[model samples]
Target: MIVFFFWLSIFIIVYTYAGYPALLYLLGKACRKTKEYEDYEPSITLLIAAYNEEDFIRRKLDNSLNLDYPSEKLQILVVADGSTDKTAEIVQTYESRHVELCFQPQRQGKLAAIDRAMAFARGDIVLFSDANNIYEPGTLKSLVVPFSDPTVGGVSGAKHIIKDENTLGESEGLYWKYESFIKKQETRLGSCSGVSGEIFAIRRALYEPAPRHIINDDFYLAMRLLRRGYRIVYVPQARSFERTSYSKKDEIIRRKRINAGRYQALRYFRQIFPLKYPRLMWQVISHKVFRLLLPFAMIVAFLTNGLALVPGLSKGEPSILRLTFPFNWIIFSIQSLFYLLSVIGNISAGKQGKLVYLPTFLVNSNIASFQGFLQFIKGNETALWEKVKRADNGEQINA
Candidate 1:
């Protein structure tokens, strides 16, 4: 039973990381005829929810106003949720005539803010954004063009993590690039796994109010549409330029928040795979669910592998213990060393631990997932959260 459990854990970890992506790559090869989307310009409400963002509010409004779209067709609205700082004042400057400001006296979290603002929204389409994430001049045009396809329910824009010399920034940029590729392939297969919250556009008619404590509003919105048999397309041409958190501490806070939401989603959206969506079910299981469960699998694998190393009174090694005793020990040693590096990486400054960025990133992210699991299990996770201080160059926007 020990060996059985050990190999099962190993298999799950391997399948979660390597095997699943490989399967997606093979499936991507069986492509279908591309559908040509015509130019589309629907009435748009650029909805951006801001907490205390006095530093970036002006720039955010500037970028929103400068998008290459007809001003008459687009209306920008900023939701200032319980902001006590100059954030509300700055936003109020552009109110009424240019941008509409929805003020909530008390902090009701992001979902509630959106619910209140949606009441005032008159657009045929709703485009969501983050305060610090700057959109490119052509993002609005690129985002809406896919709406021409009747089957495309919504579209997620590409997030271009700014190139910074810091290891944290570089790793984030690389991770996003990898995500973009996966999203592109998922769309090719049928639909994307979820939309980027920073820059996703949905038809206002299809928009449903998010639960008060929802963690990942973007994913919730997109999945709800997918359940109704609509494809969420990922458009790489439309872009939001963002910078990374200064260090793992900052990133972990954001990651913990996101993972907590993910756990909630796993339960709240349990019936994701209906009878008609076998392929989509496979994609969701492989892409999202497994990734969510990976941290637990890693813990189990580490524990079970250590148990397998105990003195074996039995003569030959079990087939499940495919690696020779010495080799197994070596692999465990390497893994131990990697984890040790992660510890050191966490303690030291990012520049000092630049060489171990990849290992540190993977370890910290998994650890954050575990933290999120705890938060979910304790029923302490909520939509309202303290935004971590970022690089000031439009740094982290909570996940």
Candidate 2:
């Protein structure tokens, strides 16, 4: 038990901090930097899915209209899925003025809306954007530059989490910065396991209509491209900004939904075994599969450590075991403290205050992962969208 505890703790730490980053660094070192191009313009369609986003639809249209691409080369499509608000109306207000609005009165999920929008897209490349996120002026130019490589089928932009004075925002921003770094490395190696849904582009020829029930269309679409022997490159210079969850509770709901998607993807794509898909195997296993299992690993580590400390487990070396007990206790104490901080973070977030709560955010993410597993097992996981409340300002974060 003692041996198991020691190794498990080491594994958790290494996997989370050391192993992931090291793999990314090595991959980044191996990847050839994308080359510059002077005449790389490609006709592009920008697809945005809006669900009751009346407040932000006009801004989104304004942002699209101001993109640095040629007007004749750019086409913008907005799909308002069962939006009861003025979202569809607001988008239609910009019709023939560089925007087109597609409305479905009956409520369907995001994937369905995207599918309907894709049928009408005429561009060689289709870029997906969310209603709430705003792209930088030249983001489109940089996003498309990567596709100049024939091997590249899809491209994703860096997600910048807008930082706020609130603790929830700070923690979320920090977490995403770390994630973006990892993605950069993964792209260098070959392809990232997933792409941010907020800002990503795919060749229309390589586009596959996501299933109506698919929860994470961006990840699924990226993986499909990989399966077809195409690379998904990450463009760090291209950026999209959006607000973090308004509070810890909102963050939890959003994360749990995403975790549920992770579980679903794992089940759906089990055919990409380690031996068969060796190159991408590590990326998927480490980034998605192992992450889903981490909460259980934490539990096992704690229980095994506790069992090792009990009497009769270490019969011959009572003194040695006793001396090590404090170390085990210290580790367990830290784990508990992290949980406490998470609770504090959640409470503080409800009151809209900053608490420098990294430990809390980490614990909360794992807890949500565990809950997502339960939801998946119970068959309660649905692809239906659940919108999380966001910060009022609609700023972008670098998390």
Candidate 3:
């Protein structure tokens, strides 16, 4: 019984990380969706939310102003959610420059700020953005072109990490590349799991008021559309750039919060899983559900393997396949070695050694996710969060 559970956990963990993406790649080839792009022009509301982000507001405004879209057709709205700094003051200056400022006196949360702005968003297509993330010049044009297809209700643009010598940045770049691959394959199979909030657009008519307490607003927005049978396409040509968190410690806070939001999603989105929609369900389970569940499964696998080895070790002559060593002991030792590597990797954080760094990252992520899960259970995580500090290298941070 212990052996069965032990291997079962192993299979799940392996499949979640490696096997699922591989299978998706093969399946994507067989299941294809055709897209037709035309010269489509629709009014776009570029909504950016900021909280105590004085320094970034100007640059983000500059970035928004630079997007290659017709000025009359594009509306730039900046929502300052009770910023205590010069964020609102600086935003006031942009009013003359065709940027509309939505100043809410109280600091509710990101979703609340977005909900407030949505009331005045007078565009056919509402594009959501962050204060720190910068969209490419033609990104808006690319984002809107998909609207020409009636089947595409929402479109998610690519998020590209700015590469630097920062250890976290290097690994984050690699991680996003993997995500990009999955999203690309998902698009080939028709619709992706969710959008990168940095560059995602949805038809204003399909917009729903996101629960203010929601942690992952982008996920909920895209998902609710999918629930209505609208296909959400991921477009790689539409790209936005963001700097990675300066350190793993900083990144963990973001991950934990995101993981908590993911847990929140599971409770509400159970009806959309594999049973109702096989392909969509497979992608969600493999791409999303497994990620949220991995940490708990890891704990189970560890305990079961240790317990399985106890009786065999006590017998002192356990053997497997004509060898004197028991299978349980060997597997347990391997798991132990992996944990040890994780310890060393954590110590070497910020150094680029993929072999050592990957294990450490994996362990730290699971730990953060598990903590996030606990927070959800305790009802501790609120919609608001203290922004993680990134590098002060002149790049404006979206608070």
Candidate 4:
């Protein structure tokens, strides 16, 4: 029994973090690349959903206007969902310049806002973006390129975390870099299970009105496309830049909301399991389900290792067992150190000058996941958007 538990813990951790990714890389490499279509220029509508984003609206609008796509083929729609601030005014300021401003006094939710915005969008493709993220100059062109393939129903752009002097900034940026690498590998395999909310493009024909209660509309929408036999491509060259959350507290709030969305997604997408969607089940399980359970797996590993350390529990075992005892201590010690660093990272985030606070960021994320899980169980998680403070060029916004 002890040996079974021990091996199980090891397998969970290794398969979740390392083995799965290795298998994905191998399988991705084995798949044949689809032929590229060159003469594909489809009309695109850029949809921006804003809620009390006064500070960043103008900049986002300016960036949208400057996108490299042909002006005639581009349409910009900004939906101000119950903003009691200057968000509506800022978007209205761009009305004369091909920007359509949609404002509703009642705030239903983000999905509702998106649905309302889509009604006004007239284009072959609809691209969704957040109000705070800034798209690179040629982001639209790169994002739309993958749609040349008729099977490609949706495309997700890479998120680029702008680096700053703060440790949180460094950790956030590094985490995104790692996520981007994994996304690329998953895309190469076939389709990534989810895409960044900041940037994703979908065919207008595939657009469906998401349930108003959906927390992660972007994820659900993209996954829905995949479920309908559409390919979801990851376009790395299409970039969206945004700052890390202002502080650890703010970051926690953001992550908790995201984790809650993950839980909700699991419940909604229960059909994409191992026995159900056999063809794409491996990708979905590896990319989405495993990630949601990783924190619990970490806890299981720690507890199982602790149990194995008790003297009488496995006494007089093989010499190999005794030799491996110290290794367990070392692993536990490292985990403790990581937690300590996370605490330090939280404390020193705004004040310190360090460039890498990986330990702090990682620990904080897990902590948020725990809180998010509790929220999910209590039915406290909602589709309501919670704003995170943003930093632009070293200055903090009231967001």
Task: Give all candidates' CA lDDT scores.
Answer: 0.81, 0.79, 0.83, 0.79
Q: Which candidate is the best by TM-score?
A: 1
Candidate that beats the other on lDDT, 1 or 3, i.e. the better one: 3
Residue 288 alpha-carbon offset, candidate 2, angstroms = 1.3
* TM-score per model over all chains: 0.93, 0.91, 0.92, 0.92
**What is the alpha-carbon lDDT of model 2 when measured against the actual structure?**
0.79
lDDT of 1 by residue, 249-333 (tens): 8899899888888888888756543336888877777777888877877787677667657777212653436544765576678
What is the per-residue lDDT of model 3 for residues 1-399, given as tens digits with 9 covering 90 to 100?
665666678878999888988987888887775566898999999998888887677898988887789999999998998889999899899889889999978999999999999998999999999887888889988889989988889999998788767766766777788889888888888889868987889999999987788888898888788877888898888988888886778888999999998888887876433345677877887898888879978988899877766645334355542123467678778889888888887776456577666677788889989989998999987889759876448855332
lDDT of 1 at 327: 51
Q: After superposing candidate 2, which stretches have Cα over 4 Å from the reference?
A: 30-39, 271-275, 314-323, 349-356, 394-399
Q: Candidate 4 on 252-368: residue-level lDDT in tens?
A: 999999888888878876543334456577777776677667677667766766766677664553443342465556666765676676667666625443332776777688778
- After superposition, the stretches of candidate 1 with alpha carbons farther than 4 Å from their true spots are 270-275, 313-323, 350-355, 393-399
lDDT tens per residue, model 2, 2-57 = 66555665586569666988867876776656345454789999999899998778
Clashing pairs in 1: none
Best by lDDT: 3
lDDT, residue 332, model 1: 72
Worst 10 residues of 4 by lDDT: 314-323
TM-score of candidate 2 against the unseen true structure: 0.91
Q: Model 1's lDDT to the true fold?
A: 0.81
